[model samples]
Target: MSAARRRGSPAAGLCPAAIDRVRIRCPQDVRRAAEALHAIAMDHGMRAAPAHNIADKHTPVDAEGNNLAREVFGWSDRKAWCGNSRIALDSPITAACRFESEPFWVNAQGFRTSLPNHYLAAIDLANFEARAMTRAAIVVPVHLPFGQIGAVSFNPLDPALTELDDLFALQGDAFGVYARTFVASYEHVMGSLQALTAAARLSKREVECLRWAAIGKTDVEIGMILNRSRATVRFHVYNASVKLNAVNRSQTVFKAAQLGYISLAS
Candidate 1:
């Protein structure tokens, strides 16, 4: 769906005007724009390319991680032009990365807030601490219905490049447009998987349990507070977890918070 153009993006940091002037474009329009981003990055002595992802909170990684149109810039591979990451499926996978334990889910940047903004991942950086990859990385999170959250990854293949979200955010809107069109065209490929969110109607008990979980309450605590048995609380949590397609409590909490089922900070 074409979202109505907004006048501003959240907290436009360094290049507010540039981001505001940015517009959306399809694969055709991107032919020129992608070149411009690459050229601009190179002019600054950097390399960069665009990546697109679909909005399915099911996995944090882009099911189609890389955007080949980006090859025009300088990237070497297109296998990722359409790839997937397990982020949504398991972002801070229990053992893959050493993420500090937080009671609930976090945005891409690892913040416990659901404010309308985007997130970036450091892992996408080319070679941080001896990692063999590109130099710079930019990530943008797009929220869609049914708990679908997709994003774009722009990583300049330069092995010496270094920048933060601010640099790439300059083309925030442009990248946003490019990603939208890419997904729209590729939506057919993504197909209609089952919705991974709350049911058509969440039960009052489910809301109560979710609200309690938002506050970091365990089943025992919630049961005590609601005058029910721990098993009852467990039942509610299990039901909600299944509905969100979450395998564990933390994931359920995170997905629920992501969907506004509960306030992350509250």
Candidate 2:
């Protein structure tokens, strides 16, 4: 295990007092907790976007109905941060977050992750400046249950600063803990509906079928391996797709893997 995981507290670098202040229980607590993290980020010469759902266009709002992005980071331009805009679709920073769970810094040059991810390199950074808006940022990805991906990015106040290597090194882990805690708590308290339908449950046979399908097994091939008829295998797979609300066979397998019904690794 990594040293950070080995530690008792995920918020290793933060004091207990600061960590306590970062917890959110109700919608009212959202702004308070976000401010606490914003203060910590500012101490390190960075501005915080306390909570952001990468897939959503609207930024998360507190009880008082203040937009966290505008209130905390002072970014008035909503489209610049996130929306159905070209920037939202083509941002390298958010793209990197999709591949990387750990904290990573990015600039116009490229992404710097704890582990080398060739996936980040494959992302087109052609209009990085125009898309990403910031010159550079230290991003913490918060991958939540049911495939919801949240993120918090700390950008340097100075527009001229494009490099965040030193700042990220000093504060990446702490930022990660704070970012995850704030976003996760906020989501738990504020999320109106579950990502999956209530009927989204699979049977043993369905799981068995998906496990085989995830590894590229055809229905006939899976039936041969599982000692079932191809028609029976198809029935289980189709039932699994209905439960998962998946449109196609591939989506069925993908959602099954996401919900832990089947292991894609296996």
Candidate 1: give the clashing pairs.
24-177, 47-156, 57-148, 59-88, 59-89, 60-87, 60-88, 63-83, 126-133, 126-134
RMSD of 1: 10.2
lDDT of 1: 0.46
Extract clashing residue pairs from model 2: none
The digit string of per-residue lDDT tens for model 1 on 182-249 reads 43333424436656632444578987998998888888999999999999999998988888788998
For candidate 1, the TM-score is 0.46
User: Residue-pair clashes per candidate, as listed?
Assistant: 10, 0
Off by over 4 Å in 1: 1-50, 53-74, 78-172, 184-192, 195-199
lDDT of each residue in 81-123, candidate 2, tens digit only:
7433554466887787788899888888888876677788887
lDDT of 2 at 38: 83
Best by TM-score: 2
